[model samples]
Target: MKRDAKNLTNAAALAVFWLAGLTTVVVLGAVIGYVLVNGVGEIGLEFIFTNPHGVNAEGGIWPTIVATLYVTGLAMLIVTPVAVLAAVYLAEYAVQGRLVRTIRFAADTLASVPSIVMGLFGLALFVESMGFGFSVISGALALSFLMLPIVMRTTEEAIRAVPKYIRWGSYGLGASKWQTVSRVVLPAAASRIITGIILSAGRAVGETAVVIFTMGTMINLPVLPTDPGRSMTVHLYQLAMEGINMPAAFGTALLLMAMVLAFNLSARWLLRRNRRMQG
Candidate 1:
């Protein structure tokens, strides 16, 4: 009787888990299918290349695309080096103690903070106090705050994942700490670091609140970093909210999803290629 009860419980648990997985997959498919169905007909080369011109601004999103790229690129430039260096220090140089724990804890706390609050902070500090105004620079700075902790945490985890034996082996070869980190440790952690970067980049690309609050809704091309601009997310939000153009909004959403998906896949492919080459 006990054995039979155990088998029943096991079967019930398996069925529940299977149902949950199936539900998740079905929901994801529904969302993707909806977007693709609504947006595919609206996507075209002309819609992507030219500036918005017609009534209700129902033209292409060229300037917004450029601004999004500029903002995301600048944020990456600002955050990547600093986050990586911080991760290296925490993972390699710092003694595992209260201070290290505090830093990690602080990073976690900061990451948990609401993104709208970060946007407001950026509005106060970068846009007004720093006199950047509604510009790409302000947006990039604002977005960097969001990306920093993500990159740092992921990188530190990746670096710590490297085996202690590898470092000891490097030291066995009379290599300095910096030499081992630069030659052995970093190479091993590179793929995971790239994955972190890609994750942060995907977040950066889709950010609307921070970009909208900092960059302002300027359809003009961002010729300079200080120039005010609009990103795709902001444009999509405006279109959807104001009921200006539903088709264009759907197209923007689809394109945004595609950009993130393509970037993610490409980064993973590169990591796989690197692994194979190293092997």
Candidate 2:
């Protein structure tokens, strides 16, 4: 009787898990399908290549695209090194005491803070205080702060996942602490570190509020880091909110999604290549 009860409970749990998975698939499929169907028709060479014309009612999102790439790239550049280094320190060097705990707690707290709140903070610090004055650099700095905690935590986890045996082996081979960490452990965790970076990039790509607060809605190509610009997300929001260009907004959304997918695929490819070269 107990055996039969156990089997029944397992079956029920399996059914619930399957249902949840199916539901998630259905929902995601529905959203992607709808966006592609509506947006694909609006995409073209001109739509992508040319700048907006006639009060942004018509033309392409070239400037916005450029701005988006600039912000994402600069933000990644700022966050990657800092986060990775911080994670390495936390995982390998820092004594597991109040300081470590406090840092972890701060990261967790920052991660939980809402994006809009972060945007406001960024406005005050980067835009107003730093006198960046509504620019790509300001937006990139804001996004770096938003993504730092995520990248740091993910990197810490990846570093911690490296086997103790590997570290011991390195040490046995006369490698110093820094050498062991840099040459052995980091290479092992390269794929996961890249994955974390990709996740952060995705967040940077989709963020609107932070960009709006730091990078003012300047619909032009930013010639300098300090030049104000509008990201693709900001463009989409402006277009949709003004109710002037629904088609363009949908198209921009599709492009943003495609950019994110491309980033993920590229990161995966890089990881595979790195593994192959390492092997």
Candidate 3:
């Protein structure tokens, strides 16, 4: 009954896999459900549109929302070019050498480092050394550092996933190195690259520790380059950390989740549009 035993073993493994998958889904659903239930009730039009007021009576999240947008936008602006170029070099230009290996190792190590450590590094470098003094720019720079490894790795993967045939076709057409990459391979791989960027953007939006260290915790809506700002994450952290304000904190957490969910949905829609266009 050797064949019967093998089949039974396989069946047992399948059952375990199914159970594990189900458990994960259930746990995730429960968490999201709880957050939504608690947070949705507190969200309002004013909360969504108004800026954070220093006085508790007047505070809305508008300014925090604006600041969050600014920080995340600036971070993306700074990192996108650098990350894309680095990815291109690693994937297209760099030969298998010591430097390339070193870069790969560095990227992996950076990605694995805990985010709070990155915050501490940013605090030392941007806040202390450069005397950015806890402004939006400093916060944005910190986020850019956090985002670089993720974007670079994803971009490298996307480039690698491009079919060699496409590269060969471009080369056969007498395209130069950059031309082949820009024309055939990059266009073919753009959707995946965008997806990676969107994923990283989500991470940036939710990040608290780096923002907290570099951006500061003042609840006031900050001015542009000269002033400090509180991101939604920072706001949520304040609310959550205050033991007396559980309801407000929960509500803010829910709102943050909603914003993240909205961004994710938008990204998915864009991804689908790109795929359809590509097809």
Stretches of candidate 2 off by over 4 Å are 1-19, 268-279
Candidate No. with top lDDT: 2
Query: What are the per-residue Cα lDDT tens digits for candidate 2 across 1-279?
Result: 999999999999999999999999999999999989989989999999999999756989999999999998999999999999999999999999999999999999999889899899999999999899999999999999999999999999989988999999999999999999999999899888998899889888999999999999989899899999999999999899999899999999999999988888887787788769767
Error of model 3, residue 210, in angstroms:
0.5
- Model 1 TM-score is 0.93
**Candidate topping TM-score:** 1
Q: If ranked by TM-score, best first, what sequence of candidates would result?
A: 1, 2, 3
Question: Candidate 3, residue 169: CA error in Å?
Answer: 2.0
Q: Kindly list the per-residue Cα lDDT of model 1 for residues 170-260, writing each as its tens digit.
A: 9999999999999999999998898888888988999898998999997999989999999999999988899999999999999999998
lDDT, candidate 2, equals 0.93
Please estimate how well model 1 matches the true structure, expressed as its whole-model Cα lDDT.
0.92
Question: Candidate 3's residue-wise lDDT over 141-184, tens digit each?
Answer: 99998889999998999899888987998899899999999888
| lDDT of model 3, residue 154 | 87
Q: Judge candidate 1 at residue 247 and give its lDDT.
A: 91
Q: Which ten residues in a row have the lowest lDDT in candidate 1?
A: 270-279
Error of 2 at 215 (Å): 0.4
